[model samples]
Target: MKFHLTVDNWTVQKTDARAVRFDVFVIEQKIPVELEWDDMDELCIHAVAYNEAGQAIGTGRLLPDGHIGRMAVRSTGRGQGIGAAILQALMAQARQRGDTEVVLNAQTQAEAFYGRYGFSRDGEEYYEAGIAHICMRHVFA
Candidate 1:
């Protein structure tokens, strides 16, 4: 049940190389190709996790504006706390940068998952790429 978390710039770019995991959660999951990739990559910090075999099992990215998104743990790696570890890693990076807050767009189904990290929903649910989504924000307390 113990998972190690690491945060670094462009780390995910190396381990999650092809970003196939992202394509699974973002593009293949129909989360709008636009939302899948943005200009943020150039300025964001990425967190990537490696399993016992040294393969990328989970990943996430944090933007300079405190935007935490594009997080995904390979399906096989689920239920091992990798997603939360990735989020926490990015949050730590944000804190190191003196960010006072963080924001993310949560798919309706995962809202509760993000809520555990102190994220609060800000608006009504809306459809994006045929899936329901809501804006969520988290502020340091």
Candidate 2:
């Protein structure tokens, strides 16, 4: 099936971005509400993906220091490239801001997905909010 996905940059405080992340991270993944929301949110540049019907389907954020985080795509949006679109949008924002590198703590299951985007595992695996994760980084010239 094909999907008409639109990714737009927004502040983390935006409702659309918050909705997507809440569904994917907190509700679906069982991440604690406390851990799902953090102070860095206010300082990051966020991207929210919308479907043809104008529903938020995915989200991601890029911090000023080049850290990418809070990437989430709703269950209904998975396997349709929405996640990749969100990541690309954030990466573009990073590039436009003159960032030389981007880093993220990726869930172990998603290491290969980020790898396809040139992100390499940077350190040993660890757990965050009860999920196995590892640090990954992508450098730009």
Q: Quick one: best TM-score, which candidate?
A: 2
User: Model 1, range 70-137, lDDT digits (tens) per residue?
Assistant: 77877778888889888888888888889999999888998999999999999999987787999999
User: TM-score for every candidate vs. truth?
Assistant: 0.86, 0.91
Native-to-model Cα distance after best TM-score fit, residue 114 in candidate 2, in Å: 0.2
**Whole-model alpha-carbon lDDT for candidate 2:** 0.84
Clashing pairs in 1: none
lDDT of 2 at 78: 88
